[model samples]
Target chain A: MTTRRGTEERIPLLLGVLASLAIALVAIPLVGLLVRVPWSNLGSLLTSDVVLDALRLSLISSIAAAALSTVLGVPLAWLLARRRFRGRRVVRAAVTLPMVLPPVVGGAALLFALGRRGVVGEPLDAITGIVLPFSLAGVIVANTFVAMPFLVLTVEGALTNSDRGVEAAAASLGASPLRVFWKVTLPAIAPSLRAGMVLAWARALGEFGATVTFAGNLQGRTQTLPLAVFVSLENDRNAALAMSLVMVAVSFAVLLGLRDRWWNNR
Target chain B: MCTAQRIVRRTGAVGVVLGVLSALVGCGTDSDSDTLIVFAASSLVDAFAEIGAAFEEQNAGADVMITTGGSSALRAQIIDGAPAAVFASANASTMDAVVEAGDTAAQPEVFARNRLEVVAPAGNAGGVSGLSDLARSDLFVGLCAAGVPCGDLSRDVLGEAGVTPSVDTDEPDARALLSKIVDGELDVGLVYATDAASAVDDVVAFATGVDMTTPYLIAPLDGAADPELAAAFVDFVTGPVGRAVLSDKGFAAP
Candidate 1:
C-alpha cells in the first residue's frame, strides 16, 4: 500500500519534469534567435528600405489573405459542420488538402491553375489583359490557398462542439436560416473564428515557398518578410538575424494578445 | 471523473517517455571519420555528383556528401557554419563573398564556364528566334531575379541589346525560371546552356553571344574536417574527369 502511494506521488513529479524539458526544447530556438540578434544594428536593419518594403508587403498580403480566407472559408465550414449531404466526407478531405500538401507542390498547382496559359487564366488574360503570376495578387491567392484550411478546420470543430439547441430554438421562433446563423451560430462561434483567423494570419505571414514560387521574389512587390529574411541572409547575416527577431516578436505579440480570449474561452 | 483521471495519467506517462527518447535522439552526434562534405550550386549538380562518385571510387572508405542549391543559398549555408569541406559556386561573386569572410583555404579557381540561352516553349509559342526576339511586346519573358548569376548575365546581354523586355516573372533561380518556360507559362526565359540541354524536349535554345558567359568557381573552405580529402576532391573537379563531366553537360572548359 505504501509503495503504491509512493509511486502515485512520483508520477506527477516525473510528468512535471518531462513537461519542463519539452518546453525547454521548444524555447531553445527562440532563445537562440534572441541571443544572436544584433541589438545595435537592429535600428538600421529595421529602417532599411528593403526591410521596410518586405515588412509592408508581408503585412498587406497576410491580412488580405486572412480576410479572403475568412470570407470564403466560414461558409464552407458551416456547410461541412451543419449540413448533411452526399460527398460531405470527401469534401471535408478535400478542404484539408492544402494543409497536408507541401507548400512548393501547392505553389506549383496554383501556377498550373492560374498561370498565364492556364485553362481559366488564359481566358481571363485574354479578356482583361491582366496576368496574376508574379504580382501582389498572386501572393494573396497563394496564401489564401494554403491558409484557408486552418480557418475551416478550426471553425468546423467549434461548430461540432457547440450546443445546437440554441440554433434550433432560434429557428422555431420564426427566425430565418440566415438570420439564425448570423445572430446565434455566428456569435457562438466568434471566439473560434477569431482564433482561426489569428492562426491563418500567422501561417500566411511565415509563408515562403508558395509566395516565392508563385509571386516571384521581387523587392517592394512580391518579397514578403520571410523572403526578405532569406534573401538578406544571402549577403547580410546581421540583417537576416534582425529581421528574424522582428518577426518572432510580432508573431509572439499577436499570439499573446489573442490567447486570453480565443484560447481560454473554452 | 476518476476513470478520466486515470486515462489522462496514462497518456501523460506515455508522453513523458516519448519526450525523453526524442531528447536523447536529438543530442546524439555522428562519429568522426574521413568524410568530405561538399556544398555546390545546383547548376553543378550533374558534374559534381559525377566527380563525387569518382572521388569515392578513387579513395576507398572516404565518403562525400553533396548538398546542392542556388549558389547564394549554398554560400549562405556555409557562412552559417555548415560543415562543408568544399564550396563550388556558379559565379565568382559568391565565391568572393566566402573568401572575404576568410573561410577559403586558398584562392578559388574557375573550372568551367556557362552561357545564357533564350529557351522557348516546345512549339515556339511566341515565335522567339533569338535573343533579340525576346524584347518583342508579344512575348512573355521569364528571367531570373537580378541577384542570381544567370539573371546578372541576362541583364548584361539585354543591356548590350538596348532592350528591356517586359519581364513577366523574375524567378529566384534559373531552375525555377526554366520550369516556368517548360510549363508553357512563359514564352521565353534565360537559362544556363546545360539547363536548356536537360530540358531539350520542352525547350529550344536561342543562340546568344559570349557576353552572357558565367564562370563556375570552386574553393576549399578553411577548417574542413578532412582538408586532405577536400583538396583531393577539388583537384579532381578541376582536372580531366570533372572537365569531361562538365563538357558532357554542355558547360565549356574555362
Candidate 2:
C-alpha cells in the first residue's frame, strides 16, 4: 500500500502562534490562581464553618435551580421550537432576555415582582405570610432566574435542529403527542438536555451578583461561596484564595466529568 | 514557497500583532499623567467630589481624580498596587489596613466623624422612630453587613441598644441599605447619618440612642508618584475648606 504523503494538510505557523496566545489568555490566570493557592492555609480554610456553609448553600441552590429550570424550561423550549402563534418572536425574545439582562438588574426586578411590598409579593405575603428576600429560597429563585435562560436557549436550539421525522412517525403509528414527546423526541435530544442542565447548574453555582443582590449576604442563610469569596477577599486574602480554589476545582471537575458522559456521546 | 521561509514570515506577523495588542493595553493608563489620584470611601462620594473640584481650582496644573468604593475594597486595591496618592476611608480600621501594609507615609488622621441613624421611608409608615422600633420583627430592616465600616458600626450600635432585631437583609454598603429604605422594600435601615441627610427627600433620619461615632480617616500613601501634591491634597482635606464641605454634608468635626 502506498502512503498518501501529498494529501497531508499544512498548518500555518501564524494561526498556530495566534491560537497559542488565545490559549494563554485563558491559561495564565488559572496558572496564577494555582500559584497563589495558599497551600498552608487551604486545609484550615476549607474546614472552617464559613466555607462549609457557603459550599453547602451553593450546591443546594445550584442543584435546585437546575432542577427547577428543567421542570419549567422544557415546555417553553418545545413551544418555541414547535409552535407558531401570535407574538411568537416576542415570546422567544422574552424567554432569552435574562441571558442578556445584567444579573443585578434581574435581582432588582425579582425584588419588585416578588418582594414583600411588591405587586404579586404583597398579596402572596398577606395570604401565605411567606417572605422571599434574604433567604435560601430567594437565592434559589435568583439562581433559577439567571440559569433557566441558559437551559431554555440551549434546549430550544437542540429541539429546533433535531429531526422531526421520528416524532411524526410515532404520531402516524397512533402514539399521542405527549407520548411522542416523552419517548421519541426527548430520547432523540437527551444529549442536548443533559448538556443544557450541566450548563445551567454551572451558571447557577457561579451566580453572585443576583444572589447577593436579591438574597443578601447572611452567612449560612443566603451567602454562597462567591459571596464568601468577595467578603473574605477584602480582609483575608488567604481565606479568599482558598475559597476561590475550591470553587475553581469544583467547577473544573464538573465540566471535565460531564464532557465524557454527555459531549462525546453526541 | 519554501516551508522554512513561510514559517519565518508567519512568526514575524504574529509577533507584530501580539506587540500591538499589548501596547494598546499599556497605553490607556500612564503613571506620569499629572492627575492626582485619591481613593476615598463610598460615604465620601458627595464631600470628596466638592473637595476634589475645590482642590483643582486652588492648585494650578493639578487635577484631583477620585475613586470611591467600599473602604475595605479601596484599601485592598492600594495594597495590590493601585496608584492612589491619598486614602480617605469611612473608618479608621480600613485606613489602618493600608498603613499596616506599609503603603501609608504617615499615620491616618481623623478628618471627620459619621454617626449611624435609622432611616425610614417618607411618612414613617412603619412608625419606626428609633432603635427600639427596629426590634419589631414585622418591620423589614436593612443594615450593612459586618466587615464593612458602616456594617461594623451598625452592629455596635445595635448591640449597645440590646435589641437583636430581625434583619431582612445585610447590604454590602450604606448606600444600598438607604436605597432599600427609599424603595419602601425596607421599613427601616441603619445607615450613616450623612447618607440619610443626603437623601432627605426619600427617607427620614432618626438619631440612634447608642453613642457611636464612625471616624473618617485620611492618609497619604507612601512612594506616591507626586509626594508633594499628595501631601498638599491631604492638607486640603483636613484643613478649613475640607472641614466646611464635610460639615455641610452632615459630617461632624473631627
DockQ of each: 0.37, 0.46
Over B13-35, each residue of candidate 2 has an lDDT whose tens digit, in order, gives 23334323433444213443345
Per-residue lDDT of candidate 1, residues A1-266 (tens digit): 23555566664878899999999998999998888889987899899998899899999999999999999999999999999999999999998999999898988888878888787788888999878887899999999999999999999989988999999999999999999999999999889999999989999999988877777777787889998887676657788898898899999999888867765555
Q: Which ten-residue region of model 1 chain A has the weakest summed lDDT?
A: A1-10
> How high is the lDDT of residue B187 in model 1?
89
| Model 1: residue B154 alpha-carbon error in angstroms | 3.1
The DockQ-based CAPRI class assigned to model 1 is acceptable
- Which whole-number lDDT from 0 to 100 does residue A33 have in model 2? 89
> Which lDDT value does model 1 have at B29?
26
Tens digits of per-residue lDDT, candidate 1, B46-129, equal 777777778777876565666677788777666766667798899989999899988899889999999889899899968888
User: How does candidate 2 fare on TM-score?
Assistant: 0.90
